[model samples]
Target chain A: MFIEFKDVSFKYPNNDKNVIDHLSFTLEKGSMLAILGHNGSGKSTIAKLIMGLLKATSGSIYICDTLLDEKSIDDLRQKMSIIFQNPDNQFVGVTVKDDIAFGLENHQIPRQEMLEKISKYATLVDMMAFLDANPENLSGGQKQRVAIAGALAMETELIIFDEATSMLDPKGTKEINAMIKKLKNEHNKTIITITHNLEEALFADRVMVINDGKIVLDGSPQEVLKEQTILEASGLKLIDGIAIIKEIEKTSLLSKENKEKICEALWELTFKM
Target chain B: MGINFQNVDFKYAKKASHKQLDNVSLNIDEKDEFIAIVGHTGSGKSTLVQHMNALLFANSGNITIFDTKVVRNKKIKLKPIRKHVGLVFQFPEYQVFETTVLDDIMFGPKNFGKTTDLAKELAIKASQLVGLDEELLTRSPFTLSGGQMRKVAIAGALAIDPDILILDEPTVGLDPKGKIELMELLLAMQNKTHKSIIIISHDMNIVAKYTKRIMVMHSGKLVFDGSKEALFNNEALLKEYNLDLPTAAYLAKELKAMHLIDYDSLPLTKEELTHIILGDSCNE
Candidate 1:
């Protein structure tokens, strides 16, 4: 497993109840996982735990077969990168090129190699044209692209997107979604996306839902999303067409076989559309 | 009366090549108006809404807010216009700076010259309107959950009792249920107060489900402004503006293409689409 959480549990210092309660999961290399949950469901807490920003109250976390402890924390983090929700808060440099280079410089890549890596990753995210442009002047989507470039330039084995597209417009969201797909397929990077958007989750290889800091559903998107009751209970919903199908399921108008056929047809149709 | 804009144009900088709002004209009623303004990022949706409360004066033409008239480069008492139109910015949670939720909610009413006691009263009422718990009002706003913080911020906007309310991408970060609840709350508030509501959203589903009027901006131009049906049905306008169909509308289009379902107008909600799909079965 590329990443594993073994009976992982976390609790805030001031809170009595555990925020993450006996959670366990595994992610294979080069596979994409989408973590869906409502506000304060401890979705972000999972990310922070993985990034070693917060210590677990109990249990253990393993990355690349190495136990995440005080000694291994820095080493494990070097193999991963995180993109936060707010694009404005993430920029570390004045220009796009400088922003991407900041990470490379931290890893102490030689000056010549850093320049080449910056151009390569920037081109991969389609932000090559805006290398010299000021980060403040870029659109939300463009800033996120630069953030992606920065993450990719680090050459990390894993990338975590923590509500990365929540602040963007539809076009920006689409752009970032496409980039995530490309990263998994072409770049062979293990990716974990934390989002409330079910539409974005549809593309993930696996989907895990959280509710009140507990894993409510864990399976492929098809399997997990079909449990609309569970999703709704967790402050989530199936994407539009599937949601409509779920509503149709309650009505006795259609025969069982016909309902199944319509479900398949509508699901495929909605995706293609 | 309400708000009217006639050939309004605005530029962020005097030397800027393009106007943020170019030759935009529109009318909004003070009562019973639910309008959604949508466009791509940096397409002037934000700029257009900011003009409503006199946050940004026009570079040309004029804006009439009730009895007040605002012209280019003309200074007026913005307090009255602001009092009449409450603007809730994007990520309204960031705007909460007071120690307690109640203080934050009361800030708006206080700024508008309400007495301390009256502001507290209005704040409590507004908090209740947003479905906020009374216990949370006394807690630090920072300690509340994201949804609760958002409600607190909205309560701040509502405390002033504005005739018109404007929200910029209010549902951006909320979960599915939160999004629906917030929209329902806004709808209920509008119905109860008979005040106009304006939202700038990137979510087509929310716009299709909530707002009656749709305004599309592209390249700083009001390319299309009409009913949701007209805007969603116009393929060319949608393509030109880089707008997407709401999920129900898109599903309807796909179903029509497959020759499985046919309709005169696109369904904008799941309920509407389900009705069309199930047909007589639904009625039965």
Candidate 2:
């Protein structure tokens, strides 16, 4: 496993209860995982813990087969990058080109290599045209694309998006989703997306639900989302395609075989459209 | 009576070439109105709503809110107009700065020149209206949950007793259930007060389920304004405005394409779509 958590638990200094309660999970290299949960469900906490922003109260975490401790923290951090919910808060440079270069320069990359990497990742995110544009002048979608370019320019193996699309409109959300797809399939980057938007999770290789700091449901996206009652209990709803199919199943008007065929077709059409 | 806008045009600065609001005109009643303004990002939805409260004056044309007229280069008392039209910004919870919830709720009333005692009375009433627990009113607003903090911020707006209440992207970061609960709370508030309620949203599902009137803006232009049914039914208008259908309507259309279900009208909610599909099979 590229990332592993074993019986990890965390509690804030002032809070009595654990925010993450003995949670255990693993992700293989070059796979996309979607973490779904409601407000205060510990989904964001897991991301922080993995990124070494917060120390785990108990248990162990391993990154690239090395234990995550204070001694190895700096080494592990170099292999990961995180894009937060607000694009404005994360920007450190005045221009898009400077922002992407900020991360590359911190790692002490030579000036020539930094420029090449910046242009390459900027073009990959479709932001090459806006490289000279000021971050303040760009739209929310454009700002997020610049953020993605910065993250990719670091060339980290693992990237985490923490509710990155919740602040955007549909157009912006769609743009980020396209980038996520490309990063997973073409670039083979390990991805973890923490979001409440169930529709965005439909394309994930694996989906997990967190309820009260515990992983209550985990499996393939289709398998995990099929548990309608469980999902609702965890403050989630099925995606529109699976939801329609479930409603169809309740009415006995269609045969079992026909229902199965319709389900497959509907699922395919959902993503295609 | 109500608020009226005539040929309103606004630009951010004198040198900026593009107008943020271009030749806009509309009317919103003082009572019993539920409307949503939607468009792509940077399409001027926020700029349009800011004008409702005199936060941004028009560079050209005029706005009549109740009886006060807002025109360029005219000096008038803007406080009364702002008092009658309350605007809650996006991520309102971030604006909560008072130590206690009650103090936060009372800020608006006090700012409008109400005495402390009267402000307290109105604050308590508004807190009750938003369904916030009385016990939580004394607790620090920082300690409350995200949803509760949002309710407290809304109560602050309600305490001012504006005839028209507007919210910008009120459910942006909330969960699915949280979104539904907040929308329902706003609906109940509208029913109880009979005041106009306008929200700026990007989620078509919320617009279709809760709001009656839908306004679409494109490049700072008011392209369409009418009922949800009319807006969703017009494919060319929706495409031109850069709007997408509600999930239920999209599902119904896809099912029709696969020759599974046919409907005379698109369903805006899952319940409506299920009813149409089941009703069709039963008739067959």
Candidate 3:
């Protein structure tokens, strides 16, 4: 496994109940995993645990076959990066170019190599034109792209997005979603997207619904998102695409077996229209 | 008279070059209207709505909400206009501060000089309007769930009894079910009170289903303003504004193109789509 967690549990110092209770999961290399849950369901806690910001009360974590603990903390840090919800809070440099180069500078990459990597990643996010622009002057979507460029430049094995799309408008959200798909298909980057948006979950290779500090459902997006009961229990609903299909199924025309194929056709139709 | 804007232009600061609202003009009726403002972020939707309550004075043109007129270098008492136009900011939880949910909700009415007893009466009525349980009134607002916190903030706005209510991205971070519940509550409020409700939303489906009128903004200008059907049918304008078509309309259009469904017009709701697919009578 590229990353593994076994019976991990955690509790805040002031609270008696554990926010994460005996949670267990594993991720393979270059896989896209989406973590979904209602508010206060310990979704963000799992991301913090995997990033080593919070220690597990019990059980173990392994990264690339190395046990995760204080002894190997620094080594584990080099293997992963996290992008938080608010892009403004995560920005550290004045300009887009400086921000992307800041991460490489900390890793002690040579000056010549750093510039090449910065330009390469910036172009990947389509932000090469704004390299010298002030980060504050950019739009919400542009700022997020710059953040992703910085993360990609680090060349980490895994990246965790913590509700990164929650604050964006629909257009901005769609752009970021496309970027994630490209990072998975083209760059072979392992990703863990933590979000409450079920539509985003539909884009992932695997979806896990966490509730009450435990994963209540886990499967591919096609399977897990189809379970209406589980989705309602987790304070979620079917995305509009699937919901429209289900509505069609309730009518007399479409059979259950043809639902999936027809739904895909409808999506393709929507795009062409 | 209703709200009117004429060639409004606004900038955030004196040194800022980009105009947040440039040559903007629109008119909103005082009652019997549910309007949706759709746009990409920083497209001047917020800037335009803020002018309704005089929170932002126009730098170049004139704005008249009811009888109050606001313009550059003009003296106008904004309190009366604000009393009629209630503006709910995005993430209203940041505005909550009172000890109890009831107190928090009553704060708005009290700020307008209502006596405590009268404010409490208004708060109770607003809570009922939003379907908040009476049992939770005494609890601290901070102890409630995110959805409940949002309801409390909305209730605070309702307690003011404004003639017009405007919300900016009210459902940004909520789950799907929570979003529906909030929208339903807003709809019920509009129906019962006959207040003109304006919402700034990015969700095209919600806009198609809820509002009769749509105002599309791009580059700090009102690019399109008409019925939802007109807005969806204008493919070139939608593309230029970078807006996504509503799910049902887009699906219907595609199905028509594929020759899969024989409907002449696009469906704007799931029921309409289902009817066209099944070739059944419009039972719904």
Off by over 4 Å in 3: A13-18, A108-110, A253-264, A267-273, B12-18, B72-75, B279-284
lDDT of 1 by residue, A30-142 (tens): 99999999888889999999999999999999999899999999999998999999999998998999999998888799999999999999999999999999999998899
lDDT of candidates 1 onward, in order: 0.90, 0.90, 0.86
Compose the digit string of candidate 2's lDDT tens values, residues A191-233. 9999987788888999999999999999998788778889989
Give, for candidate 1 chain B, the lowest lDDT window spanning 10 residues.
B275-284
On DockQ, the stronger of 2 and 3 is: 2
Q: List the candidate numbers ranked by lDDT, top first.
A: 2, 1, 3
The CA root-mean-square deviation of candidate 2, after full C-alpha superposition on the true structure, stands at 1.6
What are the runs in model 1 whose C-alpha is more than 4 Å off? A255-258, B72-75, B280-284
What is candidate 2's lDDT per residue for B1-284, written digit by digit as tens?
67888999989989998889999999999998899999988889999999999999898888999988975445788888888999999989999999999999999999999999999999999999989999999999999988888899989999999999999999998888889889999999888889899999999989999999999988888888899999999999988877889888887888888887788988998778877766776777
- For candidate 3, the docking band is acceptable
Model 1 chain A lowest lDDT segment of ten? A254-263
DockQ of each: 0.70, 0.64, 0.48
Work out candidate 1's RMSD over C-alphas: 1.6
Query: By summed lDDT, which 10 consecutive residues of candidate 2 chain A come out lowest?
Result: A254-263
True contacts kept of each: 0.77, 0.58, 0.58
**How does residue A18 of candidate 3 score in lDDT?**
85
